[model samples]
Target: MSTISAQAALLPTFSEVQKAHRRSDVLILDRHGELIHELRVDKTGRRLEWTKLKDVSPALVKAVLQSEDRRFYEHGGVDWKAVGAALIDRFFGSKTRGASTISMQVAVMVQRGGRPLGHKTFRQKWDQMAAARELEKSWKKDEILEAYLNLVSFRSELQGIAAASRGLFGKEPSGLDLKESCTLAALIRSPNALPAVVGQRAALLAQSLSPGEPGEAYRRTAIDALSRPYRLRPYLALAPQVAKILTAGAGQGELSAQTINSTLDLRLQRFALQSLRQQLDLLQGRHVGNGAVLVVDNATGNILAYVGNSGDSQVDGIVAKRQAGSTLKPFLYGLALEKRLLTTASVLDDTPLHISTERGIYMPHDYDHRPRGPVTVRTALSASLNIPAVRTQLLVGTEPFADRLRRVGFDLRRSAEFYGFSLALGTADVSLKELVNAYRCIARGGIVSPLHLTPGHSGRTLRAMDPKVAYLVSDILSDPGSRSVTFGLDNPLTTRYWTAVKTGTSKDMRDNWCIGFSRRYTVGVWVGNLSGDPMWNVSGVSGAAPVWLEVMNYLHGNVRSAPPPRPRGVVAARVPAGHGEAERGELFLAGTEPPSVPAARPAGEAWHIARIAYPPDGTIIVIDPDIPEPNQRVFFETENEAPGLKWRLNGELLPPGEEGRRWAPRVGRYELALVDNGGKVQDAVSFEVRGQNQ
Candidate 1:
C-alpha cells in the first residue's frame, strides 16, 4: 500500500452534515408559490445549505469529475497516479495539473470550513488525503460528492452548488444541462477566471464530451445569461418582522424555517404599491416623501398587502406609531353607545367650548372653524367634528374611553391620564396596523382579530365591543349624506359600493390618513413625510383617500360592499322631527329606544311637569370662590308648581314655595327633595358641589 493511503485510514468519519443541512436564506413565497422575497442571511453568518446527492444533476456530477478528478470512483481516497504525475512535474519545473481527488477536496472543504485552495504545501495535501481515506470507510461516494459541492466556493461571497446555480444561472442544480454543467465545472477550478477564458474551456469540454452537438460554435451561454439583471419582488421591508415569527416557535427550534408562506399576493402587492407611488409622484413638489398602504381581509384577518413605505423611507410606516387624529372618533362614539350614554340619534353640541385643565383652559373647535348647531351623534361622527368629539369624550369620561381604545387593540402605551381630553382629538399615537385592526373590529361585528401575515396562523378573536353598537357606528360612517357636511357628496370617499370610511388630518398636517373597510376587506392608507414635516394644504381626502379609493376600486372590481345584516337586539325606530336632520332610519338597542312622547301636551287643568329643572340631576356644579356668597347661590326651579309642595335640602325640611328660590352652594353633596302635604317625597336629586372654582 502507498504511504499516503496508510495515513488516511487514521482519521474519523462525518455523516451528520448531510442530515443537518439548512439554507441560510429564508425564502418568502406568495399564495401561488411564486418567490416574493428572500432573507439572504440567517443568524449563523454562513450561507451554507445541504443539498442531497440524489437531487443533483448527473450531468453536472460527471462534468465535475471529468474536470477535477477523473478515476474518482476507481481510487479508494488519494489518487496516487495523479499525485505521482504532479510530483514528477514539479521536480522537472513544469506547470502542474490537478492531482487531488473529489474525496480529498471534500475533506478539506468540510474540515477546514471552506478555506480557499489558493496555494497549499505538500503537508496540507497529505493531511487532506488522510481525511479523505477515513471519510471513504464510512461514507458513500455520493455523500462525499454532495458535501464537496455544497461546501466549495464558486465565486466571491458565493458558496455552495445551490447558491452558484441560483446566482449564476438563476436555476437549481437539478436543472443544469450538459453545456451548463461544463460551465459550472470550469468555474470550480477558477471561479474568478475571466469570462472569455471560462467560456472557451467550457465550450471545448462540452464539445469533447458531445461531439455530435454543436457546442464548439456556441457562445458563452452561462456568462451571457448571468450578465442579465435579475429582478425580485421588493418585499424586504417586511422580512425582519416575518422572520421573527417563523423561526422560533413552540415546536420549531430557532431558525427552523426554510420558507415563509405569506398571505400576501404578489400581484396585488405590485398593484397597491403602484397606486401609492402614482399618488406620491404628484405630491412630490409638496415634499410628501413617504406613504404606506395596508389591506386586510375582514373575514379572516389576513393581511393581503402590507407596503411599509412607498418613497424609499427606511422607517416602516405600517407599524410606525403616529398621532391618530380624528380617525379615533368611531371608537369613541361606539363606546358612548355601548355605555348607553348616547345613541345614533342623540344630540351633541358642536359649538366651541372651553374645558378647564390643570395646565390651562382647553378649547376645541371644528376643523372648518364653523359651529354645527345641535348635530346628532351620527352627523357629528360622520363629519368628524372636533368640538362634538371632545364633547362626546366628556360624556364618556376620558380615562374610560382611553381604556376602551386599548382593549380594542390600539397600543396607547400610556395611561389615559397622560392623554386626557385631547385623546378625543386623537392625540394618542398608533400604528397603521393597530388602527386598521381596530376598524376591522367594527367590520367583523366588534370582534378584534389580529392581522395574520403568514398563512395557517389563526389568531384569537375577542369581542371588543357590542356588535349592535358597532353596526350603528358603521351605518353612520357609511352614510354619504352625513359626511357630505364636510367631505361633500362627490368626494373620493363616496364609492359606488357601500363602504364605511373616515378621513383624518393630524394637527399641523404632519399626517393624513384614510381608514375604512368594506364587507370583505379593510384598507388603510397614510400619506405624509416620514420625517414628520408638515404637508402643504393637504388634508386626508386629498392625501390618502385617493390612494385608498384606487385600491378599493381594484379590490371590488367585480364584487360589491353590501351592507351587513342587522344583528339581533337592534331595533329600527323613527327619530322625532325637529332633530338635527330627519333620521332616514334610526337604529337603537331594543330596550334602549327613546320613549314615545306626544307632540303636544294634554289640554286642560294646567298640566304639571315633573322633575327638577335647575341644577340638573348629576350636574357637577363648580363653586366660584371669587364671587360673593349671595351671587354664588344656585337657583332651584321646577317645571310646574303643585299644591302643598315643600322643599328639603339633604333630608332637612325647608320653607314651601322653593320655586325660584336660591340656595348657597357648598363643597359637599346636597340631596334636594320636594314633598307633598303627606310628607311623601315627590321629587329628589343628589348632586355634588366640589372643587374651588378656578
Candidate 2:
C-alpha cells in the first residue's frame, strides 16, 4: 500500500481512482438495439458508489456485513472484535482475522485506487482511513454506503455490490433481491470467485444474518448458484463480442451507435449458431472434426450468417486464413469458361497430365486417387478432378489465377510463388468468408457482391470474369447428370432448384472445409484444431461435407436444390455419332457436359429410392421385354464372381438359394435369401427399386 499524498487527500471524491476502478460494462442489444443480451466484465473487484446504509436495502447490506464482517457498524472503520480475536490467537493463541473494515477498505481502495492485500501496511491503512473519513464527511451516509457497495472487494476479482450483482445475478443493482443480496453477502467471505463457494458463503451469511431462517439459508444457496452462467448477460453472451471487435477498429467514439445498427440480424445469427452446432456435432461424430462456416445472401451479399470457426475456441476460423482446397476449382474454371477458352461440353482430361507452366509442371489426382481415363471436362468438373483443375490453372496462367481469386475476395498475392500446382489444390490461403463470397459470385449469376456487416451499405461489384462463363461453371455445378458430378462423388449438382457446392482442406491437414451455395444462400465451413496439426484422415468431404450438407439442406428451404438457368450456348443436339437402335437417343451436348455433374436421373425423391441403389451387389434386368405391367418378371443379374452376395429390397427376401443368395418376386420390400457355409441363414438386406425413368 503506497501513501496517498496530502495533495491527493484534497481530492476527496477520488473520482480518478473511482474511474480507474470501473470495469467494462455489459451491453445489451437486439438486431436493432431492441435489447437481446447484456452483461458486465469486471476487471476489478472494487466498484463503489454511495447510498446510505439505511437508504440501502437493509436485508441486502445486513446479509453482506453479517455474513462478512460481523462487527462492521460498531468499529471505527475497522473490525476490532475479529482483530482482538485474531490478536488473542496469534499473540495469545492463533489469530486468523486480518484487521480490515468497510470504511478502511473504502479508504485504501479510493486512495490507492484498489490494490491487493499483500501491500496492506500501517501507512496504507492510515491513508485509507484518512480518505474514508474525507469521503464520509462530504458524502451522505447513503452515498457512503453506495460508495462502499461500489468499491469494496469481497473475494478474488469480486468487488463492489454492483459488480457482484452482475457477476453473480446477471442483473443490475435495482434488481438485486433478498436472496441475491444474501448470496453476495456470503461471497464477500471468500468470493473464491467460484460460484459454488459464493453460494455456500451466501448460505453461511444467511445463517449469521437471520440465525433461524432455514428457508432463507436454502434460498441463498440456490440463488447464488443460479447466478453463474447468467453472469454473462444475453447480449454479453452473443453480440457484444462483435462490438468489442468493431470498437477496437473504430476511433474513440460511441460504440453502441456503430454496432447496433449493423446489418447482422439477430434471428439470422441465432439460425447460424444453432445451425452450426447441430450439424457440426453430427459431422464430428463421423470423425469429420471442426471448421468455420459463413452464409451470405446472393441477392445482397449481406452476410446472413457468418461462423468464424468450428467453435469460438478454434483457431482457424472465419478470421483465420488457410488453404482453400479443391473448392477453388470452380472459380478458376469459371474464369476460363467465361473467356470462351472452354465450354461446358469441352473435353478436359481427368487422366494424369503434366502442366509445365512458367512456374512448374503440376500433377494432381482425383479424391480417391482413381483415374477414369478420357472423361469429358463436364465429368472432370462434376467429380472435382484435381488434374483438370490443375490443367485449367496452367492454361489460365498462374498470375491470372491469383488475380481472379483476388477479384473474388481471396487474398492470395502475399504468397505469389505458391500459386501454380498448389493453386488447384487450394494451396493459397484464404478465410472461410472469402471463399464463401467467391463462390457466392457464381450463385449470383456471376455478379461479385462483396459482403458487409451492415445491410443497407453496398459495395461495388467487379466483373472479374464474364457472366456466360461463370454461368457455364454454375450450370455444370447445378447439374447432377453433368459429366463431373459422378455417383461416387457424394456431392451432386441438384435440380430441385436449390444446390451447388465445393469443399476444401488446408495444408498439412489441419483444416477441412465444405463451401456450397444455392440461388439464394451461400455457406462455407472449415474444421480443424488450433495447433495447425491436421487431424488424421480429415479431408473436405470426410470432415466438412456432412456438416455442410446438413446445413445446406436446412437452408435450402429444407428442400432439394434447383439447377441454374440453362445457357443458350448449351443446346440439346441429336449427334451423328448416334445412328440407329445401336446409337442411343439420349440428350448430348454439342461437345461434352461439364464435369461437375455426375450422370444421374432427374433430381427427385423417387430416384434416390428406398435402398438397393445404395450400391447393390446384383443388377435387375426385366425378364419379359414386352412387359408393360407393374408386376413384370425381373431377373437378378448376380455376376457369378459375386457369389455369397445377398440381394434384398424393402425387407422381403427372394426364394432360398443354394449357397447364400436368392432372387425376389417383386421390386418392393425385397430382401435377398441368404445361407452361410455353416448352414446358418444370414440376415436380409432390404431395399426398393422403381421404374426406369424414376
- 517 in model 2: Cα distance from truth in Å? 1.7
Misplaced by over 4 Å in model 2 are 1-58, 61-162, 166-244, 249-262, 265-288, 312-316, 355-362, 414-417, 483-496, 506-510, 558-694
lDDT of 2 by residue, 1-694 (tens): 3243462455456345444443444343443755433333334332323323444556777665665556665655546576567568777665366666666666555545554355556675566566655555555544445566776665556566655565555666666677777766665545555565556656665666667757555554555455445343333344444544434443322232322444555665666666666765765644544555676777787765555544556243676777677778888777776555765545566777765668666567776777766545555776677777777876777777777788877877565565656786788777787878888887776677678755476789876656656665665554444332443322322222446666666666767877778777887877776556656676666676666665666666655444455544344322122111111112223234434443332322111111122223333433343565655544443311222334433433335454223332343434443332222222223345555454
Per-candidate local distance difference test: 0.77, 0.56
TM-scores of the models, in the order given: 0.70, 0.61
Candidate 2 residue-wise lDDT at 455 = 49
Q: Could you give candidate 1's per-residue lDDT for residues 532-628 as a string of tens digits?
A: 9999888889899999999999999999666677777777655665554542346776666667822122212221213456665567898776887
Quick one: best lDDT, which candidate? 1
